[model samples]
Target: MASILITGGAGFIGTNFVRHWRRAHPNDEILVLDALTYAGNAANLDGLDQVRLVVGDIGDTELVRQILRNHDISTVVHFAAESHVDRSISGPAAFIETNVVGTHSLLMAAKAEWLDRGSGRPHRFHHVSTDEVYGSLGPDDPAFSETTTYSPNSPYSASKAGSDHLVRAYHHTYGLDTTISNCSNNYGPYQYPEKLIPLFLLNCLRGIALPIYGDGMNVRDWLHVDDHCQGIEKVIANGRSGEVYNIGGGQELTNIAVIDAICTALDRAFVDTPSLAQRFPAAPAANGQPSASLKSYVTDRQGHDRRYAINASKISNELGYAPRRDFAAGFAETLAWYLENGDWWSALLDKAQR
Candidate 1:
């Protein structure tokens, strides 16, 4: 059986990707290595017997080497990283350690494993990345393409950019078959509450102030987690080695607009909640007023990128990788998932501080 080693499989995108992968490739063996960090939850992978979950850091070179040998892992899909920009600003050292050094360790281990095999048998390494590596874009600069120059602004993005370069170098210098995909902002179930959409959703639910950074006009192309996983599958299955594909939602919205949309969804969903009554407790009110009133602007993050969009033409045209989820439907489904699964993340958020 073809074996794949996936890092960060307990986190948001990682968990969703694992689920997606299992369904698409039922016969493949999946070995998930995750540190179970604050954001990574064992509960996320609770029912998947097909996956072997191991709690460990990707930085543990020897451990990774052992896992590769024991499992006979031939493919790797790396998703491990310090992902939150706010946290990265407060503690950049962790970001560097995990995103850069950890990737290096994993790559070295994989290289050693490949060398030990010493054959032309096909193997692939898939690197999952973000569009933040392209930094901010003006309204008219067009979306970031696969060929866009790297201009990472935040420490998190910079670290990920470093990892991306390392993956490319491994492909060129070490003859490792690797594919990279840089995706736009992802919003869906299992995402940490610290991100924009979930944070606002929770804040609105609890009657807390919804914090918007700066004027909240920064624009981002939002991709659903499922769409991103689909893109990764396409890249892994059909993409040219050492090539980067940009995966975009094809729907762009300002930060303020996104918050407004969530608030609208919440208000419509919770017409009888106490928070809604406190904000707009009137029978004659125009349906959705209170959710919009929860907005509370905060100081913007340092080095916050203004706008990010992706030119996904290459993935679509070349690999026939059309996104199945559009922004409106995907956002609606995401909001529904959060509402239906409050216990999952509420417990996670409570434990994250401890």
Candidate 2:
């Protein structure tokens, strides 16, 4: 069985992938390395069997080297990074240090262990990235393909783009077996509340105003975390070396559309429980309405991309990777998960406040 090192395994997509990988390959050993930043929650990975967690910075070369050599890790799924765009705009240094420097450190360590120290066995280093690296698109522009020119708009996307280049450099310069997947926006369980979906969901539950930035016309391709993980698995298993794949859910929706969807789901959820409205008395109202009426317009984020859509045909045709989750159905299920697991997300918010 192969030992796989999943960096940032405690974060949203990383945690989902760990759970997915555990079920799909029960015998394969998994090692998680996370620094447990504000976005990382250990509880997201709780109750899983046979997976080891190592809390540490990915930039620590010695620590990364030890883990690679000691664990006999043959696969590295690099996910650790400061990924929030707003945060990156307010403070780009953390993004550079973690996304760029940390990725470089991990790449060097992996190269040392897999290529220099041991016999050159076939190993994999899969870099998980975002479609924002391709920059914004106009209304009539085609979806971003693997060949899309890199024009990262925000600092977070720029940092990720830098890391993507590093991975490519390692593959070409040193023959390190590597692959990359640039996915669209991911929304599902265990996602940090700062993101749009979960953030609006929590606001709807707590009876607070769902703040929509600017006119809320910015568009994003939403991919469920589970579907994204499946694509990652397919890429790792069958993807050609030194290749890049685009993974998308094929569901494009504006930010306002996403919020409206969540509001509708919340209305259904609270249909029978009128008393729930009593709990969140402070929920703002618009034009004398209630709940979803609480949607308030806010200033737009700086450097916000106008639109991001992914053309996943490369992965679909080459590796037979297709997203299995339908947006409406999967989104409802995701809302249900948050509704049932209130304590899980509540505890995370509590910790963040502390």
Candidate 3:
């Protein structure tokens, strides 16, 4: 059994991956290192045994080195980053510090433990990245492939691109066994509500306006967090070193289309179950009104990409990776999770206010 270090293991996609990894490989030791920032929560990782969480930043190279040495960690799954585009625009420095500098620190420690120590032990460093690094695509442009050129538009994407380059550099210059996977947008349970889907879902329950940026025609490929984790597992288990793979859900839709889908789901739930009306009394559907009424157009995000789609054929052909969840079933399950676990997300809202 291998001991693995999971950076940002308490965040949305990271937490889901931790849960997924545990189930798939029960004997592996998991060391989770996280800064517990606004987006990362300890509760997200609650109820897992044989998993130790260290509250710290990845920028602390020494801390990571010790974890690698002490735990005998053979794999590092990097998921930490300042990922929100709006936050990055308002404060780009933090993005650079965390996404770029922090990633470098992790690479440094991985190199030290596996290479500098002269142990030359088998190690894998898998960097998780976003497809935004490829920049905006025209509505009819082909999906982003592994060979897509880097043309980041936003601060967040730029920082991630920088980190991606660092990972590739480390592999070529230092011979560190590293792989990278760029994935599409992910949504599932335990996701921080600041993201579009969960945030809008919460608003639907509270009778608040669903804010749609600009014309809301922006297109994105939506990947279920579980499917993304499965793709990552394939990459870790069978991917070639120094190669990049793209993971996608095969579901592309406009921003307005997504909101409309959510509205339709909520309306159905309220109709099928009367108790939902009592639980979420403020919901438009609960009060005999259409949920679509809550949609409100707002200012567009600066440098927002018009479209992003991933050509996942590389991973699919190489490692037999394919997303299993269809958008309708996946979304219905997501809505059910949010509806049943109001307390989970409510706590986040309450704390954010404080």
Q: Across residues 1-354, which tens digit of lDDT does each residue of candidate 3 receive? A: 889999999999999999999999999999999999999999988899789999999999999999999989999999999899999999999999999999999999999999999997899999999999999999899999999999999999999999999999999999999999999999999999999999999999899999999999999999999999999999999999999999999999999999999988889989999999999899999899999999999999999899999999999999999899988878988999999889989999999999
Give candidate 2 regions above 4 Å deviation.
272-289
Per-model tally of clashing residue pairs: 0, 0, 0
Each candidate's lDDT (Cα)? 0.88, 0.91, 0.95
User: All candidates' TM-scores?
Assistant: 0.94, 0.96, 0.99
If ranked by lDDT, best first, what sequence of candidates would result? 3, 2, 1
lDDT tens digits by residue: candidate 1, 38-116:
8888899888858999999999999999998888887899999899999999999999999999999999998888765
Best by TM-score: 3
Clashing pairs in 3: none
lDDT of 1 at 92: 97
Off by over 4 Å in 3: none
